[model samples]
Each structure stands twice: as C-alpha cells, then as structure tokens.
Target: MEYQYCETDPFKRPTHLLEANPRGMVPAIREGDWASGESAVILEYLEDRDRDATHKVPLLPTDPRLKANCRLWIDHINAKIVPSYFNLLRATDRTNQSEGIDRLQIEIRALVQAADERGPYFLGADVCLVDIHFAPFVLRLPRMLSQHRHWSDPIPGTRWHMWIEALERNPHIMATTSSSELYLETFDLFMNSRLANGES
Candidate 1:
C-alpha cells in the first residue's frame, strides 16, 4: 500500500482530518473506506493486515504469550511513560518540572528493567510492537531532556543507554528518526511558543 504523509498542526487542524477524527490528534490512518485514530490501534491494524498478507516477517511475535507481552509493554509506554515525559516537557514552573523529570526517570528505570530481561530489544532478538510504539518518543528523548538543562546520564552501565544505542543502529528506527539538528531546532521553537502563551 502507498502511504501519503499529511503534516498536521494541532492548533489549526485540517477539516478532513477533523471529520475523520473529531479529537484532532495525530498518527491516524485511513485505509480506503475505513479510517481509524490512535497510535496503538493503528500499529495493531497494520500488523494484523501485514500478517494476514503473509509478510515475510510479522511485526508481532507468533507465540500467543509473547504477543500478549508485547501488547502489555506497548500499553504501558503509551499510558504511562509518554504522558510523564510530556508533563515534564510542558511544565512551566521549575519545581513542577523538576518533579516531572524525577517521575520520568523512575519510569525509564522501570522500562530498562523490563527490557533487560529480554536483552537488545523489548521482545528478545527482534524489534517488535513495543519498540515501534516507543521509538518516536525515545528518538526525541535525549534532545528533549537536554533542552531543559536537566540532562544526566542514565544510571551508568544500565541497559538504558545500551538499549538506546542498539535502537540507534536499527534500520527501521533510523528510517523513522529525524536528524537531531532538525529535531532540536523544531522542539526549541515549539517549547518557546507554548511558553509564551503561558501553557504548561
């Protein structure tokens, strides 16, 4: 299937998208007559579609237990980790921001422990749904943390750094990530504009 990219601005969304997804959030997909919203659901839809097509390498594991585990982690990352990271980023007050960072660090450590059990990727040797779900945020994390002047090395010798390093080498991840320079520039402008509006 051919993919078409639509750049959306949350502050001023396009009418067609608003019709498809009233919430106006991004990462939505439209497959012919069917349209769906939310990242996790979209990932599942793509994975199921590919599996049905008998793709050479299915994104989800074949084993039922392993597939369930992948879904669990994906939910955790979306529901817990991503929100904490965003809270830290948008916080205008120093104290609240610091607390938010601390919470994020705790969440990261938990994620590290989870990934360490499987090694390399969240689901053993191969990149799976968990990795795909979290990759976009993980790619942006180092820069986002640094921009706040609250950067610190992930506890020395932990899988936190190793996991990030391994992810950097993954072909799929590399294809998805923006250049650090571009990400930093865009993020700076976004934060500044949001701050100017007294948003948190």
Candidate 2:
C-alpha cells in the first residue's frame, strides 16, 4: 500500500477526498472502485485482507479477547485522546488551552497505564493495531505542542515513554516519519482556522 497527503488548507480539503469519504475524515484508502475511510475500519480492512492473502504478520493479536481489547483502546484514542489533541492545538486562549491540556494529559495517562509493563510496545513485544493508530500523534505531538503551546512531556518515565522510544526506533516509523519543519508548517496553518471532521 502507498500513502499520500490530503493537500489540506484552512478552508477545505481536497475535492477527491470528499468524493471518496463523505464524512470528510481521513486515513482513507482507495483501490479502483472500492474505498474505505476512518482509521479503525481501515485497519480492520487491512488486517482481514492481509490475513486472507498471507496469513502472516498479523497486526492485531491472534487471541479473540486480545483483539477486542485492542479495539477498545483504539476507540479510546479516537474518541478521547485524538480529539483532545486537536482541541488543545486549536485553543486560542490560556484558559481553554489549559483545560485542553488537562484533558489531553488525563486521556494520555489512561493510555499509558493501559500499556503492558514490559519495555516496548503497547502489547509488549510486537507493534499492534493500537500502536499504529496512535503513532502519528506520538511522533508529531512533542514538537507541535512545544513550539505552539510550550507543552512539555507530562508522562515521562512511564510505560508510555518506553513504548515511544521503541516506536521511534522502528524502521518503518523512521522511514515514514516526516520532517519537523513540514509538520510544524502544516500545524501552524491549521492553528488559526478549522477544518471539518477531525481532519486538517
């Protein structure tokens, strides 16, 4: 699979993205006539499709209970952490930003506490669906928030930091990671204006 940017601006997203995803959310994938949107659903689609083909390298754990647990956390990240991050970034005043930061920190701390005690990865030995879903925010948040909001890492010396150190070392993550300059530039643009459907 290939990845690409959505070419977003302050006012709107690209036309093609709206055509593919009516909700205007991203992490959308298209292959000919078939297309899917939303990060969680797209991840499920990839795993199922990959399972039918190779049956090797499952992103989700094989156990039924473990897989369901992964889904629960994914929903937490989506419904809580992600929105908090965006809300924090979009906040214009100190009061709103402080509230946003507090909310985001609480949500993040919950996720950190949920991770396995073993050093690396949420599930403890291998990267899984939860990590993939959260990695973008992990990679970008430090620089973006620090530059804009003077935010600092609140959960240092926790399981979350350990897992992040591992993620930073992952070859695939290193390969796909964008420059800080580019990320901050895009973030600066969005800080002033809003985009729809949790995308920007």
Candidate 3:
C-alpha cells in the first residue's frame, strides 16, 4: 500500500476518496482494487491480507483479548488522551490553555500506566494496530510540545517520556518520520511567530 500525500492537506489525507467510505474519514487504504477507510477497519484488512503473505507487518495480537485490549487503548487515546493534548496547543485563552494542559497531563498519566504492561510497542515487541494507529501522533508530539510553549511539560514522568525516547532512537521511525533537525527548525519558527504576536 503506497501513501500519496494529498496536496490540499499536507498531513497526507484525501477528501473525495472518503466518499467510498460511508463515514468519509481518513487513514484509508486502497488495495489492489478494493478500498477501505477508518484506521481500525483498514488495519484489520491489512492484517487479514498479510496473514499468508510475507514482507508485511502483523497487526493483530495472538490473543483475542489482547487484540481487543489494544483497540480499547487506541479508543481511549483517540477520544480522550489525544484530544486533551490537542486542546492544549490549540487553546486561545491562557486560562483555557492551562486547563487543557492539566487535562492532557491527567490523561497521559493514565495511558502511561496502562502502556507499562507492554514494552517497545503498545502490545510488546510487535507493533500492532494500535501502535500503527497512534504512531504518527505520538512521533509528532515532541515537535508539537517544543513548538508550543504552553504545551510543554504536559506529560512529565509519563510513559510517553520513555516511549518517545525509544521512538526517536528506532531506525524505522527515524527513516519514516521527520528528523530532529527538521523538528527543531519548525519549532523555532513557531516560537518566533508566537513571540512576535506577544501571545501568552
């Protein structure tokens, strides 16, 4: 499955492509001919297609309950954990910013506790559906936190600290995502603009 960065959305998303998907959401996959949308459903399709094929990553856990648990964790982070972090960076009011960061910290702490059960990935060594689902956001968090001063230290002492460290050091992640240099460059630009605006 090749990924084409949508010109309109630099974050790699397609608009009309979602028409095939009833929900019109992203993170969709187009196979040899068929297409599927939604991260969880797409992930399941990929896993099923890779079951007998070589050269692809396995997403489903060996245990049924563990697979369900991974999805639960993904849902928690998507609906609660990630939105909290996003709110902190996007909040306009200083008071709202503080509240958002506080909420994000609380959510991260809980996620870190649950994440401790697995080493490396969300389900141990193997990267599963949940890992793939959240990988982009988690990988980008450091850069986002650094760019937005109000979002710094939002998840101190959380599982993300270690997870991020490991991610930064991973060859696959480094090859796939933005480099530290790029992150710093963007962070500096964002900070300069915020400072110029006299924003708190």
Candidate 4:
C-alpha cells in the first residue's frame, strides 16, 4: 500500500485527495483508484485493512472497556485539548490570553490525567490509533508551547512532556514529517501575524 501525505495546511494546499471523498481535509491516502480522506476516517480505514498493518498502531483491544476508554480519550482530546491549543495560538489581547490560558490549563490537566490513567502509553506499552490521532498535534506542541510564556510550566508538568518523549524516542512516529525547525518558523510567522492583526 502507498500513502500520500499532504503536509501543508488544508487551506494553503486547497486541492487534495479529499476532493474525491469530500471529507473536508487532507492527510489522504490512495490505494490504486480507492481514496480516503480526513485524518480520523483515513486512520480507521487503514486500521481495518489488517491486524498487522504498520501505517497506524493497532486499535482493537481484547477488553471492550479499554477500547471504549481509548475512543473516549481520543474524543476528549479532539474536543477539548485541540481547541484550547488553538485558542492559545489565536489569542491576541490580555483578555484573550487570560481566557485562553485558563481553558488550556484545564484541558491540559484533564488530558494528563487521561493519558496517565493507562500507563507508559495511551494504551500502555503498545501504541494505538488513539496515539496516532493525537500525534501530529502533540509533535507540534513543544514548538507551540515555546511560543507562549504561559505554557512553559504546564507542558512539562502534564502528559505533554511524556508526548514529547514518546515522539522523539519512536522513529516510526511522524518520521516522514517536516523538521522541527520548519514547524517553528511557520508557527512563529503564524503567531506574529495573529498577534499583530488582533486575531483571536
């Protein structure tokens, strides 16, 4: 199987394999004429292919509760943590900073607890799609955290520190993704523009 990863922001890239599937995003994968889009959907489809497929970590678990817990954490991170990070990025004035930081701290605390609830990994020793779903964002978190003075303490105090450790130690995780320096450059430009424009 061949995977085509579009690394640009979807708005910047415009056209993607998602045009074929209409899932409102990239990170699309094509197998012959078949295509799938949207990170979550593409990940699920790929996971279904085989138990041993390496594109993603295994998702199925022997215990139904563990599976449910994995899915629950995935959803919680997407709904809570992701948005709070964006809020932090887009924060402009002091008010934005205050509210964004508050939300971010709460979400980060919850995420840390959820992540620690299992052990070594989101699902213990072996990683899973839950880990993958959050990997891209987590991989970028350190750089993002560096941009904010407020994040310095929370990052290491929370599961975010563990995330950095995992991603760095695991060669298979986002090994094909761009260098940290590039992400830093673009993120700085993005934050600078957002700050200057009073965007939130």
Candidate 5:
C-alpha cells in the first residue's frame, strides 16, 4: 500500500488525507473508499484480516485470557498515560510541568505494576499489543519532558529501564524510529507554537 505522510495537526490536514480518514489523524489507513481511523481500530482490523495467522505475525496472542489482558492494558495506556503526556506537553509553566511529571509517573508506575513481573516486554519475552500501544508515546514523550521540563527519568534502574531497553532492541521499534535530533526539533516546534497561541 502507498503511504502518505503529512502534518499531524488534525485541523490542518491536507485534503487527500482528510478524505482518506475524516478524523484527519496520522496512522490512518485507506484503500480506495474504505478507510479506518485510530491505531487500535486499525490494529484490530489487521488482526481480523489475518485471523487464521497464515500470513503476518499475530500481535495478539491466541490464548483468550492473554488477549483480553493485553486489551485491558492497552486501554489503561490509552486512558491514563497518553492523556498525561499531552498534559505534560501543554504545561509550559514550571508548576504545571511538575504536576504533569507527577501525574505521568503515577500512571506509569501503575502500568509497570500491572505488567508481567518476568517481563522486559509486557508479556514475558514476546512483544504484544500492550507494548505496541505504549511504544509511540513512550518513545516521544520522555524526550520532550526532559528537554522542556528538566525532567529526569522516573523509576530508573527498575522495570521501566528494562522495558525501555527491550523496546529499543526490538527490530520494528528500531526501524520505525526517527533520529533523536529530529524528534526534539519537531516536539520543540509544536511546543513553541502552542506557547505562542497561549494554549494551556
């Protein structure tokens, strides 16, 4: 399938992408008139298409309990950690940034506690949906937090560190990632634009 990358600002999307998925979000996929928005929805669509697992890796496990558990954690990440990351970004002032950092750390600590005790990945040695859901925010948010808020790593030398190291070594994560320099530049620009607009 052909890929089109564009500005992630939903209100400012290019017409083609806006047509492909009316939500105007990045990570939308379309084929002709058919399209899907949201990463979780897209992942479920892909999983359903390959239900027999004859082609492509099965991201959700075959076991019913394991699959449900992964879904639970994905929801937690979506509901908790993800919102805190956005809050942290919008928090340009020192007091708000501190609140953002505390909020994120609390959410993250809960996630770590819920994760498999034996894991570098959420589900023991294998990468799963929980890991996938956490990956984008986990990779992008911390750098912004550190650069803009003087945030140091929270829960260092613990499972957080192990989990991050495991994700870093995963081929898919490594391959899909942009350089740290570019990541910083893009995030800084977004933050600055928000600040200019007096967005909280």
Candidate 6:
C-alpha cells in the first residue's frame, strides 16, 4: 500500500485537513472517499483492510479474545501511559515533575508486568497493535530521561531491557523513528516553551 504525506502544523492547520477531519490531527488518513481520524482508528482501518490478504503480517491477532486484549492494552497506553509521559516532559516545576515521574513509573511497571509469557513483544513474538501504539513514546525514553536526571535505569531488569532492545531492532520502528539527537533537540525546545508558559 502507498501513502501520501500531508504535513500538518497544529498551529497552522490546512483547509483540506479540516475538511477531511475537523479535529485537525496529523495522523488522520484518507483512503479514496473514506476518511478516518485518531491514531487507534487509523491503525485499525489499516489492519482490517489488509486482514484477508496473506502478503502482510496482521497487526492484531486472529483470535477474538487476544485481539480484544490487544485493543484494551492499546487504549490503556493511549489514555493513561502516554498522557502521563507527556505531562512528565512538560512539567516545569519540581513538585509537578516529581509527581509526573512517579505516575509514569507506576504505569511503566504495570506495563512490564503485563508482558506476554511467551516472550519479547507485548503479545508473544508478534509485533501487534499495542507495540505499534506505544513505540513512538517509548523510543524517546533513552534521551528524555537520561538528559533530565541521574536515575538512568527507569525500567530495570532484563525483561524490559530486552523488550526495548527488540523494539529498537524492528525494521518498521527504525524506519519511522527520528534520530535520538534530533528528538532530544525538539523535545528540549518543547520543554523550554512549556517552562516559559508556566505549564505543568
């Protein structure tokens, strides 16, 4: 499948995008006359559309119960984990920052404990929707936490470390990910702006 890039600046949203998706989100996709917004919806569309085809790996499992579990974890990450991480990054004051960090640590531990019994990826050996949804945020961890504080090992133990290692090794993730240095530079700019605005 081919995709066209439509660069969206949240500060200067284009009219075409507003027409396609009133929400003005960057990841909104338009296929022929069909259009969908939100990362979860867009990912589901892609997965469902290609499910019958044998050429590509299915994003969600074929088993109904497992598929439901994947969706649930994806929702958890989107609703709880990612927001907390963003809050931690955007926090300007030490009190708020500490609180954010604590919240994120709890979330991370829960995620780690929920890892599949079989191995690596969230759901056994396959890189499912949960991995896809969480990868963007987790990829930033190395640079984001390292630069901020002395507590380097936020996610301890070999299991989490191996999981992260597997994610970094995945070709799709590597292709989509920005360089750590570049991500850190952009993150620092965003954090500085948040500090200026006195936003927690």
Output the number of the TM-score-best candidate.
5
Ranking by lDDT: 2, 5, 6, 1, 4, 3
lDDT of 6 by residue, 1-200 (tens): 56765554443568878767788765678877888778888888888877888777688888999888888888889889989888887666678878888898788778877878655889878898989998887788776765773224544446777778888899988877776777767677666666677764
Q: Between which residue pairs do clashes occur in model 2? A: none
lDDT of 4 by residue, 92-146 (tens): 6768877887887787667666775544467667777777777776666666665
10 residues in a row with least lDDT, candidate 1: 1-10
Model 4 deviation from native, Cα RMSD in Å: 3.7
Off by over 4 Å in 3: 1-25, 54-57, 153-159, 178-200
> Which structure is stronger by lDDT: 1 or 6?
6
Q: Which structure among the candidates has the greatest lDDT?
A: 2
Q: Would you estimate the TM-scores of all the predictions?
A: 0.83, 0.84, 0.69, 0.77, 0.85, 0.83
Query: Model 1 over residues 91-134: C-alpha lDDT tens digits?
Result: 76889878888888788777767774646777667777888887
lDDT string for model 2 (4-116, tens) is: 65544424666777666766666577767878777788888877877866536678988999989988999999999999998998887888888988998899889878888
| lDDT digits (tens) for residues 1-200 of candidate 5 | 23444445443577777786887776787766888778899878766766775655578988999889889889999999999988887787789989998998899889889888888889888888889889887787666667777767646668888898788788977766777877787777677778778775
Residue 8 error, candidate 2, Å: 5.2
lDDT, candidate 2, residue 43?
80
Clash numbers, per candidate: 0, 0, 0, 0, 0, 0
| Runs with alpha carbons beyond 4 Å of true place in candidate 1 | 52-55, 116-118, 155-157, 185-200
Poorly placed runs, candidate 2 (over 4 Å): 1-11, 52-55, 154-157, 195-200
Query: Against the correct fold, how does model 1 do in TM-score?
Result: 0.83
lDDT of each: 0.75, 0.80, 0.64, 0.68, 0.79, 0.77
Model 5, poorest ten-residue lDDT window?
Answer: 1-10
TM-score of 3: 0.69
